[model samples]
Target: MCVVTAAREGQQAGCLVGFASQCSLRPPRFVVWLSKANRTYRVALGAPFLGVHLLRRDQHELARLFGGESGDDVDKFARTPWRPGPGGVPLLTDACAWLVGKVERRADWGDHVGFHLTPVEACADPLPRGPLLCLSDVAHLAPGHPG
Candidate 1:
């Protein structure tokens, strides 16, 4: 799982995403799909950048915070330590690794939206300690948006 964050008009939002992957090799493109019903999707609509984070096995709490809670009723950022990434997107400090990407395009695909991103900046834990969290790790989480 991954946490995708965006900021707009001084407001920030993030949510867990299972539908994201590197989609291109030549020019480097990554796509993260956000549910249209999610608060993060609303903020991301006007955002210039998105922070994509890779969570380690030990960071299950971080997943629970983002995947199990709604930003519409809770400030997901307030519960986690983060810093401004490119274009002021919120980057989770506890993430195993992260990249700030510029929005190349967006597509509406039924219940979800696709964000095509171009990596602009990135940081990874120097030690590269743990295994990245996978779908099974968060399979039990009840989505904050449930869409």
Candidate 2:
């Protein structure tokens, strides 16, 4: 899974996301799927900007931090170094690559809602990075709280 951080209102939100991809090449668009059960999804509903971060292999801790906890219960940003992006979306300071996108549309896709965003601003520091975190890396997941 990859990390996609978003911000809106007075909240900065992020999660370890597995269902996302760059869907269009010409327009350079991406899609992030989120469960309706997540607080991040609720905040993202009206947000104009969302930050997509590609985690380095060493950032497994970051994944656990975001993926294992619910934002409604924890201040996820307080534990990480981040700043507001173009439209106030939180951007991770140390990600391998980051993109600030404008959310163009949202639609329900089965159990998850798909947020399609067009990247308006982006930055990268390709450091011959280690392997990226994937779905398999975080399989058999356990949430920080009991479900």
Candidate 3:
């Protein structure tokens, strides 16, 4: 899972997204699926931008923080070093690579909703490119929001 962060109307939210993929290549589109029950989903609903972070294998702690705890109950940003991005979206300082994607569209799918993104601004740390954290890496994690 990768962490997705967004801010709208001065409220910020982040979460571990299990379903993300590059859906298009021409215009460079990506999709991050957020559970309707997840707090981030609520914040991202009308957000103009979304920050996508690719986590390194060693950053399992970050994965746990986003995937295992609910933002409604815990202040996830309080534990991470993040700053506001282009549209005031929160960007993680330690992400292997990060991108601020302008929300092109949002689709409602059963159980989870999709945020379609078109890359706007991005950065990648070239020095420490490592193995990416994947679904199997944290299969034991209890979701912050099961729905």
What do the candidate models score in CA lDDT, each in turn?
0.93, 0.83, 0.91
lDDT of 2: 0.83
**Runs off by more than 4 Å, candidate 3:** none
Ranking by TM-score: 1, 3, 2
- Write one digit per residue (lDDT tens) for candidate 2, span 1-147: 677777777777788788888999998999999877787887888789888888876787788888898888999898999888898898888787888889999999887899999999998885657887777777756765433
Name the TM-score of candidate 2. 0.92
- Compare the candidates by TM-score and give the number of the best one: 1
Sort by lDDT, best first: what order?
A: 1, 3, 2
Residue 81 miss distance in model 1 (angstroms): 0.8
How many residue pairs clash (N, CA or C atoms closer than 3 angstroms) in each of the candidate models, in the order given? 0, 2, 0
Clashing pairs in 3: none
Displacement of residue 101 (Cα, Å) in model 2 is 1.0
Q: Judge candidate 1 against the unseen true structure and give its global Cα lDDT, from 0 to 1.
A: 0.93
Clashing pairs in 2: 1-134, 1-135
Point out where model 1 deviates above 4 Å: none
**TM-scores, each model vs. reference:** 0.96, 0.92, 0.95
